[model samples]
Target: MKIARIETFLVPPRWLFVRVETDAGVVGWGEATCEGRSETVRTAVDQLAELLIGQDPLRIEDHWQVMTKGSFYRGGPILGSAVAGLDQALWDIAGRHFGAPVHQLLGGPVRERIRVYGWVGGDEPDEVAEAIAAQVEAGLTAVKMNASGRMSANGSAAELDGVVRRVAAAREVLGPERDVAVDFHGRFTLATARRAASLLADLHPFFLEEPVVPENSHLIGRIAESTAIPIATGERLYSRQEFLPVLQAGIAVAQPDLSHAGGITEVRKIAALAETFDVQLAPHCPLGPIALAACLQVGFATPNHLIQEQSIGIHYNRGADVLDYVVDTRPLAFVDGSIERLTGPGLGIEVDEAAVRDADRRGHAWRGPIWRHDDGSFAEW
Candidate 1:
């Protein structure tokens, strides 16, 4: 079947969804969410659609190469994210056409179920406690939180203590059996990340995410070597070539966003690359259902997969939640701290077309917060 129409929708609370329809009466859905930059990625998707309008829908890899490398200026967040959504839609169409799940197409099931974690707010000690408890109540065995709100370039003693204290509170609630991940969010300098890593090493967090920003990736190997905490990053990274340096940096885990890192096709290859480094894969997904579903599909097939991140009840979902646009929520149901294998075809979840259309009519222009330090210099958020 040939690709007939490609449509993009700007939904509520910082998400962009793309739909690909084939002439043979089959439709596929994918999430091209760039969080703060959905509008730009929407335009990128439209531009990329020009190459895919009449091509065969099942030629996923060929189309991905062209969409990604067709232009000289390629492989940034805009183009990678645009290609990612279309790639997901193409995979979904292939799965549906072949009457199999995407993971089965990759290879047969390697595991029976996938473990998942939720994002918890970590600004305050009480917030961390309550958030972890709520996730525990929701049957999530693991949860991730920010290391600090907007940190100074050189973290003060108070800043360092507060980070440790908030994590300590989460550790108290989660106990020993559960896991908690600390995200630096690229707010810390190399010295600051190194110091935080030394202080928090005893708590044994699931991982320290983006201890230093992507631009300073040359320093990550030093951070990884100094502390035993698993270093995870790559939400901002978009391709396997970009991930190579980080992988060689002796990181313990690689957290590539399926939406931002070239979707399934590229992330699957990334998983393989990380596998060679003996690192685990925990995809960075804090968007909507389609993105989470795509992550789960990869998790089920990937052997070195560590855990999954989902955005159900995450603080960002103000007006709409993860399950709002899905026809069946059973596939995404969290049980016993893990999601069972999705047996349905394609991405294993049905998109609610009507809900999506309605939400698009009242489109949102959501943006991530911009932070400035007390000195008025820009700070990472």
Candidate 2:
């Protein structure tokens, strides 16, 4: 079916959704957003629509190649995220047309369900023991939390102790049955990250996420050598090419966000590339329903898949939770902290288009918080 029209909406709690309509009357939805840069990605999606309108929606690979390689300047957060959303929509349409789920098209599922983790403790962690307990009570077997709040490049011993304390509390609450992931959030420097890693080793965290920023991937090897914890990063990375060097650095896990890393089309390639390095895949998804659903489709089919990250009750989502935007949250089938396979066609979750339209009318301009150190210097948040 020929693509007829493309529409975009900026919904609540910092999400951008795209809709692609075809001549055959089948429509597909995609989540194409870069958190704070929803409007920018929206514009990019509109610009790419110039090439997508009247084209065959079923030609996903061709559309992806053209949407990405079609532009000489491509593969950053904005453009990649825009292409990602559009790519998901196209796949959704293709699956619906064939009356199959996206995973069925991707060589069928390798597993019945994928384990998912929830977030505990806010940006600046406090009362983590309580948070961990609550999530455990809610049936989550694993939970992740921010390691520190805008730590300094040269962190003090107290700061290092704070990291140990938080992880210790989480471990105490989880009692070793469940997993706990600690996210440095790219807020630490090489020295600080190494120190934090060394100090937190006793807790045996599931992984340490983004110990340093993506630019410092060269340091990942050193960090991996120093700590036994699985070094996970790549949420900020947007393409397979960007992920290659990190995988080469001996990163234990690749946490590419399907919404940011060129969607299923490119992330599948990234997963394959990581597989060669023996690196596991834990897709970074902290967005809405569409993004989570897209990640699930890829996770179910990917062999290197380790775990999935979801934003259920995440701190950033105030009023707009993950299930609010979808019609059948049951299809999500989150059980015992794992989501069962998606059996429906396309991404396998029915989005509430009316809710999307209504939320769009009351569209939000959400942005991440900016943090400052005690000495008034800028710190990553």
Candidate 3:
């Protein structure tokens, strides 16, 4: 079928959705959310649509190569995310046309159920305990939380102690059977990250996420070698080229966001690339259902796939939730801390186009929080 039209909607709670329809009346949905840069990614999608309109939708690879490298100035977050949504839509259309799930088209399932983790706020000790308890009460076996809020350049004694105390409280609530992943959020320097990683070794965290920001990925290897804790990063790294260096840096887990790292097309390659290094794949997906659904499809087909991240009841959802826009939430239903493989065609879960359209009419201008240090200096949030 020929691609007839492409449309992007800036839905509430900081998400960008793309709708692609073929001349044969097959409609596919994809999410290209760049969080703070929704409008920019939407514009990129609009421009990229110029390349897809009137082209054969089944020629997914050709379109991907063109959309990504066709422009000399390409492959940044905006371009990658834009191509991601369109690529996901094309794959969705392909699966629908073939009357099979996207995972089946990718080579069929390697596992039955996909393990998933929920987010817990960790600003305060009491709040951290309550959040972890809530997720555990909801049948979740694993949860991820920020290691700290506004961290100092030089690790403070209180900051280090608070992290230990809070995570210790989380470990207490979770017991030894459950898992907790600590995210440094790129707020800590290499030295601080190393120190923190060393300190938390006894806590037995599932992984320490983004200990150092993407800019300082050069330092990732240092921290990875310094401590036994598994270092996971790559939400900010947009492509396989960007991920290669970090993968070589000895990271035990590779966390590529399907929406940010070129969708299923490129992330599949990233998964294979990570596999060669014996690294596990835990997709970084804290976005809408479309993005999460896309991650699940990739996870099912992937052999090294680890746990999946979902944005249900996450702090980012102020007005809308991950399940709010999907027609049948059963496909995304979590049973015993894991989501069963999706059986429906395309991305598996059907989106509520009406709710999406309504939300688009009253779109949101969501941006991430900016933090300042005690001395008025900029801080990572």
**TM-score of decoy 1:** 0.99
**Candidate 1: misplaced stretches above 4 Å?**
none
Per residue, candidate 3 scores C-alpha lDDT tens digits across 199-283 of 9999999999999999999889999999999999999998999999999999999999889888899999999999999999999
Query: Which pairs clash in the backbone of model 3?
Result: none
For model 1, the run of ten residues with the poorest summed lDDT: 121-130
Across residues 1-381, which tens digit of lDDT does each residue of candidate 1 receive?
799999999999789999999999889999999988999999999999999999999989999889888988877888889989999999999999999999999997899999999999886556899889999999999999998888998999999999999899999999999999999999999999999999998899999999988989888999999998889998988889989999998998999999999999999999999999999999999999999989989999999999999999999998899999999999999889999999999999999999999999999999888999999999998
- Candidate order, lDDT descending: 3, 1, 2
Highest-scoring model, lDDT = 3
Clashes of each: 0, 0, 0
lDDT of 1 at 263: 96
Q: lDDT at 225 for candidate 1?
A: 95
Window of ten residues with lowest summed lDDT in model 2: 121-130
Name model 2 segments beyond 4 Å from true. Answer: none
User: Model 2, range 136-219, lDDT digits (tens) per residue?
Assistant: 988889999989876877989988888888888889889878999999999999999999998888899999999999888878
Of candidates 3 and 1, the better by lDDT? 3
